[model samples]
Target: MRLIKAARALAGASQDELAQEAGVSRQIVIRVEAADETVTVDAVEKVRAALERRSVVFIPSTAERGPGVALSKTG
Candidate 1:
């Protein structure tokens, strides 16, 4: 999904980096991001956790705006 790509970008990570962090293959990340394959919830969770670790937060869509990602503020 676009959110995944946005989150990765916000994290300043490549697909390979995210795959490594998520404990999945680069191919898996490709497939997931392409939105052409069905991935397991666990796999999705792994990707989310990896992104979260990098301070990438996923925000659900609101009527005013579509779903998006943002980097967490740091002191």
Candidate 2:
């Protein structure tokens, strides 16, 4: 995932370092960076946490946003 690599770079962490921080193997980082489709949620969350620690903001895309139900402002 570009996000992972970018976060790792931003944090000045090597792949191995990031893997260790995320409690995963270096291979997992490599696979994730390569956009492997089999990545797990745990791995993604780990990377996300690592990025968040470095103040990396992750905003959900519009497509990934919830259904288009409107919210009442007075609620």
Candidate No. with top TM-score: 1
Which structure among the candidates has the greatest lDDT?
A: 1
Colliding pairs, model 1: none
| lDDT tens digits by residue: candidate 1, 1-75 | 878888899899999999999999998888778765588878888988999999998889998999988999960
Model 2 misplacement above 4 A: 59-75
Candidate 1: segments with Cα more than 4 A from true spot: none
Output the TM-score of candidate 2. 0.68
Cα lDDT of model 2 by residue, 1-75, tens digit: 676676567667788877887788889888888889898878878866765665555544586573222222332
lDDT of model 2 at position 38: 95
Clashes of each: 0, 2
lDDT of each: 0.87, 0.69
- What TM-score, over all chains together, does every model reach? 0.91, 0.68
